[model samples]
Target: MSSSKKARTHPQYELLYWPGKMPGRGEFIRLVFEAAGVSYRDVSNEEENGMKIILDMISPESTGDSDSNPPVFAPPALRIPGEGKDGKALLIYQTPSILSYLGDRLGLAGEDEAEKAWVLSHALTALDLNNEAHDTHHPIAVAEFYEDQKEESLKKAKNFREVRIPKFLGFFERVLKGNEKQGEGKYLVGSKLSFADTTVWHVLNGLQFAFPKELGSRKKEFPTLFETFYQSVQEQSRLKEYLASDRRFPFSQGIYRYYPELDRQ
Candidate 1:
């Protein structure tokens, strides 16, 4: 290849995610770039023997010179090729952190102090809700199956549906409803879109898919919640395209799982 082409071949950034919807993270950060028509490579998978390969790459020993900059968790990390003033060559992780960083990069973060705070608050809240959601199904242990702890699952699922799901969704509904009073916006936090909007959209999508009977039956009660989701998918062509694309991936054994026993009141 030519020298010019060789330079072009270098990726500007690398996104590390367990390819496919291990619920590695929402496609939001990835979708942000896609929406902007930028290119990225997902390094969640390698042509190798096992999960060990992926784990080893992130492990302290395998990282070679870069081990000290490792993140708190592996899924959904990003690498920007250039180093800045701090000598940090733009490697970052934690879904929210990455999203927030990208928001600043892409000019999507809300414009004002109040808006910024609201966007961050909204984004973090959505993540909190998502963790609770996963906990509902795996109340016993993540390593064990829902079927393995069917009895404990039943009890936990009962609490989730009766107490938790409604509680979290209800809080979001209140957040949306309070936007006008709080001077937030039509979106979750600011006058413009942010990671918060994306996160909320996914939570609504996951909850709707996960609990059709409980959350699904009561959709009419949360107009703004549905409105944000509806508008987001329709307007964000990249996200809409990703959702329809193979890269968006299918939901499975990672975070959000459909447990009929859990949702079936």
Candidate 2:
């Protein structure tokens, strides 16, 4: 990916996650960088043996690295050069934490302390929905194959489409309505776009892919959310280009998966 003029001054941010087409949690961090028009190295996607790099980063046998940075617990970690002790690379994990850290530097956190807090809060809530969506397809166990728990997945997906989806979508709809004075029904926090908006938008986009029929039927019920907020976030100049570009991978067997049997009949 080409770097913008503004991105040239910043450190080369490296994203370490599972390789290939799945957006996964790394997409959250990607959105922040894309929205800010900043450049970052999607290490696992761009470099050879990049998946091995992620495996080594999260290896159980390793306690810490030579750079004195603590071991990451999982994928989607961010490595920033010259940000650690003695100018070593700073390594951080956890999707929410990584997004928050980048949010501030990228100017997507919010304008002030209160907006920042709300931004994080809203982002966390959206991630909760993302996790719930994942559970629908693997309700019995994460390590086990979905086919082994197909029966359970059916029940889980049903409850998710009928209950959990509306719960989360309604909550966000109300948030946008409440913030309409400042956000004009397009943002979840303050006036401008924040990481929270992108975070929530991505989750909603995943929901559409995972449960097309369900989301299609429910869109009218949450006009502000599905119509205004969702449409606005995608139309953002940089995000619009990124969404259409090859960089934005299609939704597949990642956090969001499509199963016709799991979707609405």
Q: Please report the candidate that would top TM-score against the real structure.
A: 2
Candidate 2 accuracy as TM-score: 0.97
Q: Could you list the CA RMSD of all candidates, in the order they appear?
A: 4.4, 1.2
User: In model 1, which runs have C-alpha deviations exceeding 4 angstroms?
Assistant: 1-11, 26-28, 45-53, 60-68, 84-88, 180-186
Model 1 Cα lDDT, one tens digit per residue, 142-249: 788777777877787777778877676777778777775543335666455566777777777777777788876777766666665446544676667766766665
Alpha-carbon lDDT, every model:
0.66, 0.93
Estimate TM-scores for all models. 0.81, 0.97
Clashing pairs in 1: none
Looking at model 2, how many pairs of residues clash? 0
* Model 2 regions lying over 4 Å from their true place: 2-7
Worst 10 residues of 2 by lDDT: 1-10
Q: Lowest summed-lDDT stretch of 10 residues in model 1?
A: 1-10
